[model samples]
Target chain A: MTSVQIEVFLQTLIAGLLLGGLYALIGLGMTLIMGVMKIINLAHGELMMVGMYIAYWMFVLFNIDPYLSVFIATPALFFLGIAIQKFLVNPVLKVESILPENQVILTVGIGMVLANLATVFFKSDYRSTPVAYATNAFYLSDFWETSPIELSLSVPWTVSFVFAVVITITLWFFLAKTDTGKSIRATAQDLEAAFLMGVNVKLMRVITFGIGAGLVGAAGCLFLPIYYLFPSLGGQFTLIAFVITILGGLGSTIGAIIGGLVLGVFESMTATYIGMGWAPVGRFVIFVVCLIFLPGGVASLLKRKKFGK
Target chain B: MKKFAPFIILTILAVIPLTGLSTYMLHILILVIMWSAIGMSWNLLGGYCGQVSFGHAAYFGVGAYTAGILYSKLGLSPWWGVPLSIVVVSVFSLVLGFIVLRLRGPFFALATLASGEVMRITTENLVDLTGGAMGILIQKRTWVDKTWYFYIILLIAASTFILVRKLMESKLGYYFVAIREDQDAAESLGINTTLYKTLALCISGVLTGIAGAFYTNYMGYIDPHVAFALHDISIITIMIVMVGGVATYWGPFVGALIMVLLAEVIRSMPGLGTAHQTLFGVLLIVIIIFLPNGIVGDYKKLKRLLGFRRAST
Candidate 1:
């Protein structure tokens, strides 16, 4: 291939990786909730949307940087998640329902309420944070004067990616080293065992959900400067988070990271090669392929390899 | 009286148009029947088989597209799409079933939801055949009156009612309930869990597809958004069964009636139309928590909550 072709491919790859960092943050939240609650939070995207709106208003009203608002939004979303779990989801869990999928359906209702209420209050108009550095990018050719290919990275994208990486590392530290985090993991692994071991499983569930919502809220803040916001945007992102979870393996943090990166690259490649509209179809293709051939997802593959070794 | 209840209800519904209701009322009646048909289909798979699909829109859209394409391309009457959809949706469901039926519970639900979005996106992208986002509009509508549409949907609803009743009564129905209650136990008992699940999916999909085809003929317009709406079509189908009663036969019917009328009442109210989903969501939360079995399924609980007491013996 020509140097120009290589340059374009490299650019796309870089873009995909940057996008994947944020996607990983989103997927991490979903995987955590799925792992601990044992129920798919269909309202996950709406929580993210709530985060985005919080960031948007912060930017619009107080002139706060979208990144800076992440602090505010994450906490707000944490409370919202706790409230939802305690009042709506927890009660349903105790109820004798004909369908085991009732909790999932309840999340759907929550999502609808969130998205619709956003429409009512926000007027459904697409909005974005017009940050000062929105279009600012660093050119690779400027630094490497003798480089064969030119590359440019958007300031917002790079900053967002850095923030995502930092947050992910911190989360890893928390999950790996902290007592509450260990309890959460134990609950996710085996609910009964965790409870028998004297761990407060219910509190862990509530805290895990809060953490998941907080992470996704941070993602929303990161995405605000780069992506358009609307009420119905929650549905699509929720699906994206879900696809990532399934692709990575249900409730596997590391798997979610890998799945997010894979999805990001695949979606960017599809957009570059085919058309923008077909990018979602590409996501579904990968999902179906994963379901059929690799039912256990990347986590299972990693597990099998470790077992073999 | 219990045995004759369905017949009695059908008879009353069949003559509703004879009361010479306004066109708007007839339209609402048609919508209620159509939703019930979709709900019954969903009830079979979700309520009976325990496979709660969040993507019935995929089958529904395919059915509508099947009918729309026939009229648009083959010059056949759109009514032919109903029967043709049974075939098209069955094949589609079988293929989808192969992939999704492997996953149980919530995983299956998400997979089906993805499939619906995929179908919508596919149709939206394939502009030449499906008319893309512009949608297909029938040039010559079969009738301007609402009575015929009402009758047609009523007939479809009745047939779906009968078919579901028969299926649920037979050995197949028992297999479905067994699988729903406990798939592993059912398998241990030598029930072909996968086959029965697929069967449930096919029957459910075909019935929903038939309703979708009817929707196209009734509405005289076919669009990817309208036919494959996640919230409008698929969620409403779930809500019908969920709000009415999950496993009960009468659940979808009563749920459809309440939901359809509730939607109309909400939408017609000044300044409240835009917030209808919020209200629906609240209702859903209340039903899930307080009446998890739905109105019909948890009638005793509801009656007790309402402070109704049985006469002293």
Candidate 2:
């Protein structure tokens, strides 16, 4: 390939890696909720949207940096998630229904409400953080004058990627070292067992939902500088997160991270090779292929290899 | 009187267009009927078969586009798209069913949702065939008067009601309910779960498609977004079934009526117009929590709850 082609390829790869980091964060939240609740949170993306809106307003009203808004929005979203679980979802779980998908539908309702409220309060017009350094980037040519190819990474994207990695590491540590985290993990593995151990299964479910919401909210804050904000945009992200979870194998955190990177790279390739509009199609294509060929996802394969299956 | 109630309601509905009501009311009635038909189809799969599809718009959009394409490309009347969509949507659902029917519960629902998005993106990109995002406009509507349109939709809705009622009473319907109640048990009992699920999906898709075709002809325009809308067509279909009555015969119709009226009221509110979805979201959450079986399914509970409050008052 020509030097220009190589440069384009490298740029796309770098962009995809950056995107994957944020995607992993988004997927991590949904997967965690799915793990503990055993119910798909359709409003997962909307929780992120709520986070984004909070960040947007923080920037608009108070001149707060989007990254700093993460601290504020994450806890607020956690409480919001708690309220939804305690009120909306808990009732649905108790109410005897013919269809077992009531909680999922309830999440859809919650998502709809959140999205519409945003549309009402913050119109449908697309908005983005006008961070001064958004355009600032590290150029290969600037670093190496005699470099064979040219490539650049946007400053905000690099910062967001770094933040995502740090948050992911923190999440990993919390899940591994913390008592509440272990309880949450135990609840996910076996609800009855966890209950038998006096883990407060109900409280764990609520907290898991909160952490899931908070994680996605933080992802929203990280994504704000690099991505545009809109009310209805949540649905697309919801699909993206769903795809990542399926690709990563239901509730596997490590798998979600790997799936996110693969998806990001694949999407980047599609955008570069095909067309920008087809990027969403690439996401679903990977999803369908995963369902067909690897129904268990990356997590299952990892487990099988470890077990020598 | 109870047995004849459906016939009585049908007769009343048939004559209402003759009462010289305003055109606006007629328009609203048309939407209610259209939505009712779609809701009934959804109820069959989601309520009875226990397959809660989140992407009925795939069929709905195809049905609309089938008619829209006929008018725009084939130089045929859009009305012909209605009958044609039944065949088109059935075949379409069968192909889609091969994949989605493999998964159960949430996975199946998400797969169907993905399929709807796929159809939408395909249509948007295939501008030559579908007019893509530009949409198709039927320049000459078959009838300027809304009477014929209303009658046609009413006929569709009435037939849908009859078909649903008869199907539920038949063996096929029993199998659907059995699958919904317990897939493994049904399978152990020699019910071909896959075949039955596919059949249910086909019928459900065909019915929703018919509504879509009718919409294209009545509205004289078809677009990917409107036809295959996730929230408007798909979720509203679920909401209709959830709010009215999940498995009841009259549930879809009642739900559609209330929803359409609620929409009109919400839309007319000046400052709160954009918040209509918020109201719908609230209503759905309330229904799921308070009346999980919907208004008709939980009739006794609803009545008792109201009666107890009345007695206290």
Candidate 3:
């Protein structure tokens, strides 16, 4: 392994890992909604756009640092999610019971409304939070590389990778250990059973939505330094998030983190090796093949191996 | 009674182009007619079969690009290209259906979406072939007049509606309704769910492809953005069908007309150019909330409300 090659690999790995963190955050929200609401929330991307805009304004108007304003922005988005579920989503739940197609129309219609609403209010101009470190990359020593196996090489990523790992681990612990987390899981397993067990299913759903929104809010803060933020930018991220959510196993948060990182690196490598135009096609091929082979997601594969499905 | 319905609808539609409408109004009407055909075809697969596609634009784009490419590069008549495009896209749809039709619900939608985006990006990136983002513009031939285009679109729309109406009234329609209601139950009853789904998709794709060919030829231009946007597919097939009444014949036709007419009226309003989408959003919300069944569906509802006997499905 030459020094320059090692440097390039490190850079790619760091970029891929940071990108994965953003994917995980967005995927968390989507998976959360899927687990609790049983709705795909096609408008999830627009919600992320909302988060980015909120962060963008906080930076531009009040001179607030993107990372620091996560505290405030997260709660605001949380409230927005709660309100959407309570007012917009609840009414349609009944309708969907009668007509399953109603949910698709409702969520897709909401997505369209959100996108155009953002366009009307924000004027479709792309804006981002301008932080001092937006483009700053920390280059580690240029001579550190080792090949672990024939096909795989090990490279050390910088702070961005650490940030992603830390956030993912934090979320994993929170979900595994917290009482509210238990409520969410219980709700996901079976709504009626959870209700019989005295769980406030609706309250849990609202909180789950809030938590998901808050996660995306944090992701917006993290993402501002890495990529260009625009209203329509959410579309790209949302698609990737869906891939991650599916790859991870539809309702599993930890699976989202691992699956997102894998997908990010896979896509990065494909785009690097193949034509950029083919990258999307490659990703779709992966999705299709996975759906064919492991329709239950990677986590389900693990579950089946463990429990004998 | 069923025999006269198609004749009555075709007669009424035939007079539309010759009614002395303005070119601009005629243009909008042409678009409405084109979309009505596309929407009804979409309703066959999505609304009837319960297999929602967020990627119908793939077939539409294939049709447009096929015809456009043949005409520009090979000096072939568009008439030749239209059928070729339909064959190409129908095959594409069949293969795509084979891959995706087994997946149920949201996964199916997501898979189709991924495929559509991939196609869009491919079209935009293949600059030499697809003209990239700038798109391809064909020279307008004088013989293919705008009024002729209008009647052509009308004929296509009327025929598509009749074909779908026939299919819906057939035994295949019963199988589709059964699949939509409950796939497992239908399968248990010996309905070959896969065959019916692929059949529906093939039919849907061919019609949508033809509409795409008509659009490109009439406008004399083709672009990736308009050709493969998920928004276009969703709005035409999903929203129109939802507003009209999913799984119902004539739903998408009535829905597309109502939507296009309303959209044209809104766009014509001065100072409302940028806010036009907001109107669409509002209309969508209104349709979803109050009039969950679209105009025709609402008509039936109102009739039943006024002490009329319920019409059989």
Candidate 4:
């Protein structure tokens, strides 16, 4: 391949890493809920959808910049998450005997409700912030030619990679060094023990769920300029998020980040080498292949190498 | 009880079509039968085995596309094509099940969702084989008329209901319930959970596939969007099952009758296209929250009012 081709390839790889960072941000909810509540929130994507809408409407109505609205929208969603967990999820959590599929059904029902509610309210229209920066791109260098050296390469981030990195790091810090974070970990590891320790297991579940939703809100804030927002858009990223959470391990926060990055990079590579439509095929292949080799998830795979399964 | 129940249902089913009803009512009846049958098929894996697949549309699509291809390309009779489609879809389900059966709970659901997506994408992409997204249309066959199609679907629907009834009474049915309740405990009791789950999926796939063929043949068209969409999974099958009542044979049948009829009726009214879907979504949420037992299950609580013994419990 020519140097111009190499430049384009490198640019795509870098873009994939940046996109993966946001994927990780959005996927934290699925993994966290699974870790603590042992319930996979199928509505996780739907929650993200609502967050996107909230951010979108905030932008449209108040003319607030997409990034700036995160401060308001994230807190609102956080409380919404807490309420849903406390009232809806808590009742189901008490069942001594719950099947995995039952959880899937309940969450699917919740997701359907949220998605259709959005559709009803928003009418399935696509929206994006009309900020001038939404379309800006930066060129790094030109590729060499035999005589003139004329070919060039450019990189684009409507979401801005800096904001994505910042959100990811903030989430990392929140999960690592807070009293609530430790309680969240305790709830995930030993639910009964956490309760026995007077950790208010119920409150912790609501709090963790809230934080998860808040992270997704942050993701939506980051995603508004990068991609168009719609109800159906939830379906697209939700699929990849599922794979990312599973590949990362159900409860591991850091695992979600790594898994998201890996899947995003793999998807970009597949879209580049194979085709755009086959991106899902690439995800499915990786999901199945990973399950075959690393059933506990990629986090376990990593831990196994460092210690042992 | 066994001798009279079938005879009673058969008599009622036969008498309904002959009533002085409008052609529109007949059309609605036919649709109810088909959708109820599809819902029952979904319940086999989802309601019975506790696998909650959101991808029954994949099997449904395969069935429709198979019959459409054979009838259009090879001039084969749908009679043969329909049965052949079921076999093909069952085998496909077996392969998919082998890969995905080990996945627990939401993971399994997500995997099935991905599979449905893959099928949709492939159908849209493989223009030569599946006619792409614009869809392939089939010329109506002269040998079988619309009434014949109606009866065939009705028979299939009744058969599906009876099959589910028989299975629920059998030991295999108990095994399914056991797996759904708790897999490890069931395994401790010597049930082969994997084998039973796979069997449920295979049955579910075959039934759904047959329904697909019947649907395509009835419409004389096949399309990827309608046949293999997540919307179909969520709205048609999952919603009907929940409304009908989980873990019950007749729940889907009753549920589809209500949900579909409501949708059709609402669509007739002006300015309800958008609200129509929201109504169903809100209905689904309300059903889950307030009427967790669903109509069929709730009926048992009114056994004295209905003057019938509570059979569900």
lDDT of all predictions: 0.94, 0.93, 0.75, 0.78
Q: How many backbone clashes does candidate 1 have?
A: 0
Single out the weakest 10-residue window by summed lDDT for candidate 4 chain A.
A147-156
lDDT of 3 by residue, B1-313 (tens): 9868767877777777677777887787787778778888888888788888878888888888888888777878765667798778878888888888878877777777777788889899888888888887878553555788877788778878879989988999999889988999999999999999889989998998888888778878888998888776645566777776666677777777877887778778887766766677666766666556665666666466555444443
| Residue B307 in model 3: lDDT | 53
For candidate 2, give the lDDT of residue A129.
Answer: 91
- What is each candidate's DockQ, to 2 decimals? 0.93, 0.79, 0.46, 0.47
Candidate 4 off by > 4 Å: A94-100, A142-159, B1-3, B141-145, B302-313
TM-scores of the models, in the order given:
0.98, 0.98, 0.92, 0.92
lDDT of 1 by residue, B50-113 (tens): 9999999999999999999999989999999999999999999999999999999999999999
Residues A72-126, candidate 2, lDDT per residue (tens digit)? 9999999999998998898889989889998899999999999999999889999
Candidate 3's error at B178, in angstroms?
Answer: 0.7
Distance from true location, Cα of A282 in model 4, Å: 1.6
Give the alpha carbon lDDT tens digit for every residue of A54-168 in model 4. Answer: 8788888998887887787789889988987877766654532223354456666667777877877787888777876665554443223343223222223635456767877
Relative to the unseen true structure, what is the C-alpha lDDT of residue A288 in candidate 1, on a scale of 0 to 100? Answer: 92
What would the per-residue lDDT of candidate 1 be over residues A244-296, giving only the tens digit for each residue?
99999999999999999999988888999899999999999999999889988
DockQ-derived CAPRI band for the predicted complex in model 2: medium
Q: Would candidate 3 be rated incorrect, acceptable, medium or high by CAPRI criteria?
A: acceptable
Per-residue lDDT of candidate 4, residues B1-313 (tens digit): 9668756866786677666667677778778888889889888788778888888888999999888888767878655668898779988999999988988677788888888888888888888888888887877664343466667888898888888878878998999988888889999999999999999999988998999888787777778898898875534688898788776767888898998899898889887866665677667756665455566766654355345445444
